[model samples]
Target: MDASTFFILVLIGSAAACLLGSLTGLGGGAVLTPLLVLVLGVDLRYAIGASLIAVIATSSGATATFAREGFTNIRVGVVLEVATVAGALLGAYIAGLVDKSTIAIVFSIALFWSAWATLRGAPPVVPTGESDALATRLRLASSHPTHGGSQPYGVVRVPSGLALMFGAGVLSALAGIGSGVIKVLAMDRVMRLPFKVSTTTSNFMIGVTAAASVGVYLHRGQIEPRICAPVVLGGLVGSMVGARLLPRLRTRWLRVIFAIVVIGAGVEMCRKAIVGGF
Candidate 1:
């Protein structure tokens, strides 16, 4: 395909992916990376670079709405970001040392893991109003607005949550994703935050995490403006729309869609790896 045609397709695909990513807190890169590599025939490194740009755009676009709505836990996001940033730097360095086939295999595995965890879903978390001592000292516990009123919640397992955020960052840089799936899991399941709070906080954190890792790709000469420009523009648009719709939207169906898309992409990527198409 010609450059213009490819650009148009990328624009459309990125818009759609970012829309879903905003709603699910998975970030645009989760879906955009696979689409670029598997459908558009972009190289893995270039695709990852573009996806990181998209993730940053998506987070910036969506986070404003989430933060305004009082769903994002700023303290939690900021605290977790330290570990995420550290891990992102290490992971970006490792990505340079690995071959395309190895990266592809690891990316596919991450996708599969994301799908499985999303599908299985977490059990309902009933806030017990018992905040961990560490969480209290760190000021991690906060409240989110709900239909009835402001509902107070407590944070738990601070150490475990930080550890998981570190892993999420490593995967995010390695796979060119926001690693929001793992971030949400750490906050919602391990940290015991409300689902809405976890997702919005994860969204708030994505841009910082992507920013930390993107420098590595830029220095490596993997980022192409021709590819990244349209992706960022499209993702910004989609994420804004999704953010506007989030307050009233029920996310049960969104989770299913996220899982299906992730699984399909993982399967296709696995096939490509097996066929030596990396």
Candidate 2:
């Protein structure tokens, strides 16, 4: 394909990826990563680098709406970020030697968990375990809007939340996708935040988490400017369209579709991991 044609196809694909990602909360990385890898013949390592740019765009673009509406718990997001960022750095370093297939295997497990968490229910209201010193000082606990309406919410295992953030960072950095699902799972299931709060707050942190490692990816020669340019540009346009169309769609079916996609990725990862080659 000529340069112009490749660029155009990438643009179309990225826009669709962003749109799908925004609608489902999977982030564009999950969608775009596979496309760049399986379809466009991009390397998984660099595919991840390009996808990180899109994940950043996805989080930044979507979080504003949630924050402006007074739904996001910025304090919680910021606190959790400390752990996630730390984890991301470590994950990135570890990824340099590990095969991409292995990362995908871990990601597959994370993906299954994310879908289950979303389908099951929201986080609990009561504070379960003791809060960390920093969590107490930060006052990260609060309420969130629900499908029914506004309701009280709380962050359960403050330290565990931090730990989960770290784990998410590791997975995302390794797999080249924003590990928002895992992050939310840590906060919601482990820390026991409400579903809406967990989802929104996780969204708030994704960009920062991805951004933490973007420079590393760039410096390590993982990011190709030609490929990244189209992925980033396409993802942004797709996200705008998805956000606009979100409210009109039947989300239950969409959730199922999203889960299916994740499963597909997992299967691909499993295949590669088991075979030791893609």
- TM-scores of all predicted structures: 0.94, 0.88
RMSD of 2: 2.8
lDDT string for model 2 (60-148, tens) is: 77765556666678888888899999988888888888877776676667667766754554455553445555666777767665568
State the C-alpha lDDT per candidate. Answer: 0.87, 0.77
Candidate 1 — worst ten consecutive residues by lDDT sum?
Answer: 121-130
Instruction: Check candidate 2 and list the clashing pairs.
Output: 14-234, 15-234, 15-238, 19-238, 156-191
lDDT leader: 1
Best by TM-score: 1
Residue-level lDDT tens digits of model 1 in 31-94: 9989999888999999999999998989899876666678888899899999999999999999
lDDT of 2: 0.77
Q: What lDDT is obtained when candidate 1 is compared to the true structure? A: 0.87
